[model samples]
Target: MRQYLSADKEKELIETANTLMAKGKGLLAADESTASMLKRFQSIGIENNEENRRLYRQLLLTGSKDLANYISGVIFFHETFYQCDNNGKPFREILKDNGIIPGIKVDKGLVPLAGTNGENTTQGLDNLSERCAQYYRDGARFAKWRMCSSMSSTSYNFICCSNLSERCAQYYRDGARFAKWRCALKIGDGLPSELCIRETSNVLARYASICQQVLRKFSFFSGFRTD
Candidate 1:
């Protein structure tokens, strides 16, 4: 049986989800880690210093108030959550003022799953409830956690996905109104065999269903790489 949340809470979550999915609206996922941002900057020949990162994100969040026309929400990394634009206003405030919802990425990251050949699982469950409460108080109406399932020899499994779905229920009860899971797929000649496709799809579906059962909105972000 699925757990229950108070009607008020459920209503709030549903509203947030609907706003996020408003007609012709989408989300901006600026929750990249420092290392990932560094790599991205390197690709553009820009320095990856803190000031550069702040300026770049500031440009995105405050470049124009017209962003809310198409962007309903923005997922921010921890660092970006506290960052400010040139006017000393918090990024969250800027987004809120533009009618955009502010969200936070709460996962610690992926760690290798023991007894699996390089399989990975997301961490940061410890103190998650506390973190969610604080984030909510800090102007985040929703939170994101990335749980990934990958395809590899001896690494494909549904158990990890199942575990993440179970945890999503807990997170919702703890005040997270939304969640995200990523399934990484690699495309190549003779790769992503039938087994890979079926298993990964099943896992993603299960994750979504479980989140719905708990009244939390779910987002699926799939990574496709061709090599």
Candidate 2:
């Protein structure tokens, strides 16, 4: 049987999420895969390698404590999650010692959406709920999934949020309590940017809408809300 949350426990989790984003602050995303980092490296004219990645992350991690204060957590890729800074402190220890939580990006690289010409969705849900339980046990306070999707007249209404949101909500219910949804809108090659923006907004809105619906039902049954 699923354990229902007591009111105090529910309030505690909600307060924790708020405390995480307090003082008009947000999260620092150090979680970038090799391919994504390479794209960013191309823009900066730098090589994409372990050292380069470490240096960039260290720059952020060792920034003024003021910046660290605004950043409640640092989401790291698997490689960075295990690396150490020059002082030989593991990245996890460095952040935790500074009061910043360390999180992991658990999604596999993006894959093409079936029946969509070139669009894609994130994978890695194969054992994600179980993996999340392990990450929680391993001291991860949160996990992240960066989802990508696009909309167009040819495929404007061809969107699905059910499975993705279900998995994420389950993660929150299971252990990882905070979740974020990211969508991308690209316009080019005879496609107007405005159309892309509009479509992407619609998709994101719908995604949030569905998530809210799920949470409502979840609260109804669980007798609590993490909103």
Candidate 3:
């Protein structure tokens, strides 16, 4: 309930968000962590070194001039933030010059939420304001924090909602224009019952409401996988 952004700041946030969500435009999530990127590269028989990573991202960011038409925004990892395109232009500048917004994934990773049967929460809230301010100064207009929960029929709704609301408000105050939360559900013959579905929905709704209270655009990504 603590409001830290000025009226102008709030308006700026809203306008940026609206522009990213403009007609026929969507976000491109290119913020895979190093480990995740390694796995992806390995699957395609490519080495996952720094140069290769940089090249891959450069290709994605500068592959076509028409990308901005459909890719309104791009969420980048920390490494990509400082990378330059083939033309020596910073990736952030390249995106901005093409009328695309640049964002960063701010979560450190997932950590176990104590006293639960494998429930986890996203880390990286420490010094969040400082980090967000720096990212904003570096040409980032938005940020993402991913909070994940296991589909083990546990009552994690309370913890998930409270953590998301608190962190969403904090991130908004620190200059993030929008945020994304991912909740995953495992599907099986006798899994993902009514209880799990209802709990996930309730948690997402609560998080969305809290995000609105802080004047930030909220996006929910639900993953259905069978393990």
Candidate 4:
């Protein structure tokens, strides 16, 4: 079989993950979609406009340099990734300056899966490989795609792993190319069904395997949640 990840590459991935997930520091998930952002702004009585969005993220990225001490990394939505500070400095640079890692949320908002009750799956798979390559070139070293476990089955493992890992290996040859898959499990009446668990676990296992083969890295997970 072809060697997808060399031993050296594997070591690098492990070390990077360990450093990012150190004892106290945490990764911030600011990957909410624009629609989701709007809902949040409404909750707080603020208008959800382009400037407001940029300003909000600007505050997060332009905070005290001491932010690195508590936040190991911050995951930004695509717009936030490219958004600039008042002086035209990109937010990616701000994170780098503060010794914080920059990551991006690449998934388009969730869409309903037809023929299923309240089931949904994430979009953004179209040209995903190309987009990820471009994101890595621009500055993002890691990316995330979240899925609602109850919405889809575990069938895209092979395709996703192969597609993402193949290009990610070349793009982030030396640094990090974390392929983060955020899986959310729900707990409602007769929820978290066995099917959901199996589907999520199976897909995650595939992702993990490819990380071993081609990545040796990804948004290395550190915690789990159920709701």
lDDT of 4 at 57: 86
The total number of steric clashes, by the backbone 3 Å criterion, in model 1 comes to 0
For each candidate in turn, the TM-score is 0.72, 0.66, 0.71, 0.73
- To one decimal, what is the Cα RMSD in angstroms of model 1 from the true structure? 7.8
lDDT of 2 at 9: 54
Give every collision pair in model 1: none
Q: Report the C-alpha lDDT of model 3 over 1-227, residue by residue, as the tens digit.
A: 66545567656655765676788988898889889999999999999998899999988989888999898878889888889977788898899899988888776887765544455555676555566667777877667766565644533333334344223322242224666656554444444456555655655444444434443433322221111
Residue 10, candidate 1: C-alpha displacement in angstroms: 1.9
Off by over 4 Å in 3: 1-6, 153-175, 183-227
Instruction: Sort by TM-score, best first.
Output: 4, 1, 3, 2
lDDT of each: 0.64, 0.58, 0.65, 0.61
lDDT of 4 by residue, 43-128 (tens): 99999998899999888767666788898767888878888999999988888778777887766766765444565556665555
Worst 10 residues of 2 by lDDT: 215-224
Q: Write the per-residue lDDT of candidate 1 for residues 2-66, one digit (tens) a residue.
A: 44455676566557667776899887999899999989999999999999999999998888868
Instruction: Supply the TM-score for candidate 1.
Output: 0.72
| Candidate 2: clashing residue pairs, number | 0
